[model samples]
Target: MNQNKRFCLALDLKDDPALIKKYKEYHWSGQAWPEITDSIKSAGISDMQIYCTGNRLFMIMEVDETFDPKKKAEMDVNNPKVQEWERLMDQFQIPLPWAEDGQKWVPMDKIFQLA
Candidate 1:
């Protein structure tokens, strides 16, 4: 049996409403580039979802037990399509003030969970 792990991360969109709109449009159902989605799944991520409130963005990512974030990052660094997508998306993204150097999405600590 394969077990999956869930990780929650947070990011911020450029404060401009126009940029936010474009960001959401890019992520709309079936709107993401095939290469990007393929890379995500191939990285062992089973599912991912992003939600936004105001300028804040939250992501819920589910991945298999063998998923290694460092490995995924290394893969992304070598993938031209992923790099291209990142560059394009960077225009609408503002890394969290508290994010580490070169980090886009900041991982959120799970503080509470009923289940």
Candidate 2:
């Protein structure tokens, strides 16, 4: 594996199967909007992968040493295309019951890692 830092996050898909299918479709390689990919790259995110099972979704992000979540969040706020993509995605996503207000992807605690 690469030396980049990895963060894992979890969220839920709206319990509707159809919406979940559409969400998967939107994530297909060529289906994602170019602006969305560009924004992520510009934010210093080296790589990102999302997986789904039932109604649960997991995201694994690999970020470079220069990546700052706070800075990325601020940049995303000022990017209109990023906002539009987020709004579209919100239709298929739901925060976990324990998630704080305004939180979407809840960070996961890493319990163990082998050296």
Candidate 3:
């Protein structure tokens, strides 16, 4: 069995209960669009999960050696289905005030791990 590398990221949803509920609906209950999951797998992501508290979301992603953020980003740039999904998701997502311009899902640093 191969052990995949893990990465964490975070983003925030608009501070509205209704929109946040819809956001959770799309993500929870296995309702995510097929194209979105396909794109993620094609990008070398072996597994992904998202957790939310209040309006903030945390994501854990596990990927194989072939995973390259730059490459995945370039691929997403040209994928119409991914683009459409992103546009729809944008309605419920809000950039963290400290996020870089137009950036979503900012990478998080691991502070400590008990080994």
Q: Which sections of candidate 1 miss by over 4 Å?
A: none
Over 4 Å off in model 2, which ranges? 1-3
What's the candidate order when arranged by decreasing TM-score?
A: 1, 3, 2
Question: How far off is residue 7 in model 1, in Å?
Answer: 0.4
Residue-level lDDT tens digits of model 1 in 2-99: 59999999999999999999999999999999999999999999999999999999999999976899999999999999999999999999999999
lDDT per residue (tens digit) for residues 1-115 in model 2: 5668999999999999999999999999879999999999999899999999999999999999889999999999999999999999999999999999999999999999898
Lowest lDDT sum, 10 consecutive residues, model 2, at: 1-10
Candidate 3's C-alpha runs over 4 A off are: 1-3
What TM-score would candidate 3 get against the native? 0.95
* Candidate 3: tens digits of C-alpha lDDT, residues 1-115: 8869999999999999999999999998569999899999999999999999999999999999999999999999999999999999999999988899989999999999999
